[model samples]
Target: MSVPTRQASPAAPPPASVLPAVPVEPSPDPEAHLGLRFPEGFGWGAATSAYQIEGAAREDGRGPSVWDTFAYTPGRVANGDTGDTAADHYRRYAEDLDLIRDLGLRSYRFSISWPRVQPDGRGAINQRGLDFYRRLVDGLLERGISPMATLFHWDTPQALQDDAGWANRDTAYRFADYATAVFEALGESVPVWLTINEPKTVVQNGYITGHHAPGIRDEPTAYLVGHHLALAHGLGVQALRATGSASRIGGALNLHPCYAADDSPATSDAVRLYDGYENRFYLDPMFKGHYPEDVLADQGPGSPLVRGIRDGDLEIIKQPIDILAVQYYTPIYVTTDGGTVQKWPTTQAAWQQVYPPGMYDILTRVTRDYAPPSITVTENGLPCADEVGVDGSVDDAGRISFLRDHLAEAHRAIADGAPLESYHVWSLMDNFEWEVGYDQRWGLIYVDYPTQRRILKRSAAWYRRVISDNSL
Candidate 1:
């Protein structure tokens, strides 16, 4: 299980001006009269997905995914980028595992490509695909790092999309079958499983907005896809239970706390609308077994898209989950003009707002409002225009501050008794960022794409100390 050595890329030239100075904040130093420490046994790790990092796209009996199709379609991605050979993690898992071990990570969260496992999306097991993961899991074990597997992270088999995608209900059943296949194959070793990663992103980006894979810009189709994907998650969880796998299963939701930009009634209503569409649409079904009434009301009378929730669908979806995987990068600042709600303070992604406090706020709300479940901050990291210094070290001070602020909030949430179990940074290496492509770097490890070099950023070293000390 030896990973081939990759030559380090020549460090990028330093930026003409240093990053804007980070604002100083209060600290928890005991000598300074404040005392704080992360909870005993809080898990710390990093996350990476298959399509984003595993660049052997066409290798080992793997079939094309929607990303593969979208990336090739002229202007779908930034800078004409495609993940055909992004980080080559498929061939470099061993080296990546060493990197994980070096970071003193207790767990490594990685996604299994559905197309890679079931090349045509169903009916056949791709042994080579299984072999790659088996090797990866074994490498992690060899280094004493637990493997946390995400079943689907937006890389649906293009074959399935060609056959109607999530707009059709049958896709739910297919996803269940796929989940069972993955569980039966790797459940013995992998103790933690995530059923899906951010269904909202899948439906909104892929169908409604036409910004991501299998791009289709129809609002009705997007709503349908969203419902079907939720059903798929329910069915997938049921399938995992039916297989009697020992692994604990759940879904990773990209949840953000919604806020009104002002105290106006329109602004408050805007916040409510955003919350219905973003959080409650998924949370209510998973915890309370139905979509929120407000979400249905907001859909209005014109749309023919009805949620095809049949008898017993709620019961199936209410299946007990061992943990809730929460991926919080930023929050949404909502405002209203007349009768229209719009996002405010947009990021490079043009949708998210940089609201770090939202991390603590959302975690608190989930714990207080929903049935208590073990929670993990599965994805929390910032994308910065990182640059290597003249001395060859990348000085990503913004990212470092981002991590510190978020983790401090996480500590506060835990202190207030929010069943917090673990924290995993969004990424380990800067790889493909869906439609935005490689332009944004979200990893603690700086990736020199051309030479496939892995440079530990300042944040990575800081996080390493956090892990070693078992405190934030």
Candidate 2:
């Protein structure tokens, strides 16, 4: 791989009034100064992915996923930690559901384990696996909590990987097959279905940086996988419509709003390409039915990503979705040389730059530009080095403060006409944190991995109050 030559595209330039001498946090709106309430009926929820929380790996006829294979390889994960028994959510889901009810959460967002449901990713429904989700959803409804289930969340079945996985276009259709199976089994019992979670993570971390499962540092192949993921998203949506279940389906994307480091012609192109790669690569195809021209040019005409795209693929990727799950974790400042500069303080996860305003910018941008019918902050929270104190309690003021600031910004976004409807913190409880493993905790409830005891942190107590009051 070599330096990508910059190319200008039709991406909208920042309004002259909005661009500042240097990118800084936007000042609070006049009403935000006094604080506002999250609208009544707005969903307050918590999110957890199957690989991160549901343990029970190799149990009940469940097959292996790519993450399992990767974690088993030495030097792949921190402290040799794996999701073998993460939080024990698979066996303790009832306890977790009770925790959500105790916290006054209106919704619970979780991902279905693909390998658990369809062991090979293509055939044979696992009755035992499907029963787990059936019970989980029933329990949520019984507790008066809405269930939003994501079909795929970074844990691709290892069987699929052996056949080229997301790098192969066929996997997109295969995903629809998997989606249909889930829909037929769960039906409208699961009201919301997210096709995929954070396709960008697969391209950037898994393939580009080799930091995630099925790790590979191949840019050409990574972008190819990105395309397939988008295709899978569309196929999943189409699959749901084909069933005529009247249930809503959408894609979960992690958007990073990019800003120019300086007011220079050279920096402008850098910002365009960076934004194209980080945001538009997924957004444009989903909402606009095309790839960003600058992004296409940067890869050159003969790249694998270009050749992989066939006639009408973009149309398939542009299916109308009922809602969009926008996961905002950070912002990026692009320089003339196509590198990034940190403009805000970071969390325990160094990549997560803590600028609450970025949440507002991204939500508003997506609303103003793509105009998705509705949006939800599916995954947003701060990772802290939290622990249980001697008093049998955990005090994580940082996580509380982080959630409050971001929720304020989110409420501001809704008032500013962003059409944002719901907000979810990243994890319901501490679990496996991917490559960094169990080192950094990002949960309102602390999970003692050894005893698997769930302790409500100060943040959980504060969030419970916020949820009950429906305000900041």
Candidate 3:
């Protein structure tokens, strides 16, 4: 299908300032220096995705997801590892809920497996599949933990991929159908709903780099997929509102705040383009009702994504979301020629660098620029080489330090008038790290995968203290 054009529209001139200038080393407010406590009722939670943790790959009416296909392929995943039995969360959710309560977590953020619920990504709902989430949500509530459910977290149903996936315009509406099914089944209980998680990653990693599921190394396909994902997000928002569940609906974007590697005009240009692609591409449509002109031009006339955008598509994609979910972990430093430069300490996940100030930069930028009603850090944590000692305790001081620095920055963001409400650490426990497999550990709790035994690391214990004190 061709992208329906309204008229031959001329692209707008490039804005004088695409992003406001952010200080390289922003000093926190005076109160932050004294370590001010988070505002009352600040949400303290942890996040886990279905594909990364829930490892019931093919059971009880569940169908295959794109990730399943990718993992099963040789040389696609590290060490040929698949999420077939990841952490066994599908079978051991109750125990995990107890772990959350013990850690004093106020909320639990997790994603619903689309293929598990709809089997083929569309049509009849699978009761057995949803039963798992129902039980998980109930368990969370029973433990006084709020449930924040994400509808899709990179686990596109295999059937959808077979139909050209997000590259096809029809996939957006199909996603809405799937969202409605989930809302009808579980909407009454879930207070927070995220429509989609990290569509940029889907475009960059899955389509451009071919590092993720349904991997395709084609820029044109990535461009088309990006727009369709946005359309799906907008449609998903409407679907949630149609149910009238009074839930806060939003999309989780993994935003990378781009900066120049050095004080050079060419490097500054690279930063501008990088920001246009990484941040503005998603933020503008969600808030301003259009894609950035420069980014559209950057892809050129041959890019299908530019043509795939139909009339009134931006209007649909710009639905009012009650909250803006920001997932920040790294910042990009581009050289004069657009090459990446690494200047910070790295995590086990090589792409992740230790940059706490980027958290503050991103949150404040969203506040000043897009002005979303509310904001929450949905995912932020680092991977480390963690293991249980003979004394039956995991001493992961590195993770504790990482959390401390990041949380401090979050407090700074809130103090600086970012309207930052909640913050959720990435994974509740060590589970499947997609593509990289279980090689990287980003969890507060260590998972003994073979036995499915949960061990609370030193970081978990420290986080519990932070929660109780309501301060870092």
| Cα TM-score per model | 0.90, 0.93, 0.93
- Candidates in descending TM-score order: 2, 3, 1
> How would you encode candidate 1's per-residue C-alpha lDDT over 91-152 as one tens digit per residue?
88889899999999998999999999998888898999998988999899899998999898
How many pairs of residues collide in each model? 0, 0, 0
**Quality of model 3 by C-alpha lDDT:** 0.83
The superposed Cα distance between candidate 1 and the true structure at residue 465, in angstroms, equals: 0.3
C-alpha RMSD of each candidate structure in angstroms? 7.5, 5.7, 6.7
Worst 10 residues of 2 by lDDT: 1-10
Steric clash pairs (candidate 3): none
lDDT ranking, high to low:
2, 3, 1
TM-score of 1: 0.90
> Comparing candidate 1 with candidate 2, which one achieves the higher TM-score?
2
